[model samples]
Target: MENGVKKQDQLTPPPVPRVAVVLFVLKGKSVLLGRRRSSVGDSTFALPGGHLEFGESFEECAARELKEETGLDIGKREYLTVTNNVFVEAPKPSHYVTIFLRGVLVDPDQVPQNLEPEKCYGWDWYDWDDLPNPLFWPLEKMVRSGFSPFPTE
Candidate 1:
């Protein structure tokens, strides 16, 4: 409420859900992930991606975020799935429609670095069957739904 006016009466629209792109950078049975240090999923492991910018394609967003956060490049991305993430327990409640994309590293030998230390702990390759504890809510939901981002033999 502003100046004794109720929030609903403010003449301003409510917040809108945002679209976030999460990448599943695959190499064999492993995927690239990092521990997020942000508002929504602090201390939780999550995929390497970010919000979908205006006028940017999903593939473009995936590659750009990968480079920005992990210092690695990707190739041949395809849509894996999407998750409806509502951070109801967060300090600032927020929602996001998370688009998951799967891609292979442009150079499998290239290691991912923690380009944004303030936002993430570090990047590492986690095997599908052996992912770390306390995964970001959306990601945990994705895994629990039996959605395997890995390519089948």
Candidate 2:
């Protein structure tokens, strides 16, 4: 019944991909680091993290990934940093919106057992002052810049 004018449908926006990293702190000196299983790429060291799901919050994703990857449960989490970076890997344009969460370890003495052996080799705790250089790029920057996941009081 319209005068030859087609109704335009509203275009829905594309979904944005997100990721969260849990910086597990123990004894106020050391932080947890995991070695990404070599097959993923050349990256050896990276913070515990992964992509966010359709309806999960950043905190939930961080906690879940931390536990799945390192067998660690983060009791309390605080925001550290938010980074939006474009990572270029041929055939895939990865746009990463990453949230860094400072987490507290429930049991410091418990050793983390990797559930996904094919993706993660092992885990280690390193002092803040003596972190290894081979860590993932943005993570290296975050450490060198002295960015604490916890807020300073």
How high is the CA lDDT of each candidate model?
A: 0.90, 0.71
What TM-score number comes out for model 2? 0.77
TM-score of each candidate structure, all chains considered together:
0.92, 0.77
Q: Output the lDDT of residue 123, model 1.
A: 89
- Compose the digit string of candidate 2's lDDT tens values, residues 47-113: 8888888798878888889888878777777776788766566244456777877777777677877
Q: What lDDT tens digits, residue by residue, belong to model 1 across residues 1-153?
A: 789999777886666799999899998889888999998889999999999999999999999999999889898999988878788888988889988899998888998999899999998989999999899888888889788998775
**Distance (Å) between predicted and true CA of 77, model 1?**
0.5
Candidate 2, residue 52: the lDDT equals 82
Model 2, position 42, has a per-residue lDDT of 46
Maximum-TM-score candidate: 1
Q: Which stretches of model 2 miss by more than 4 angstroms?
A: 1-17, 38-41, 89-91, 150-153
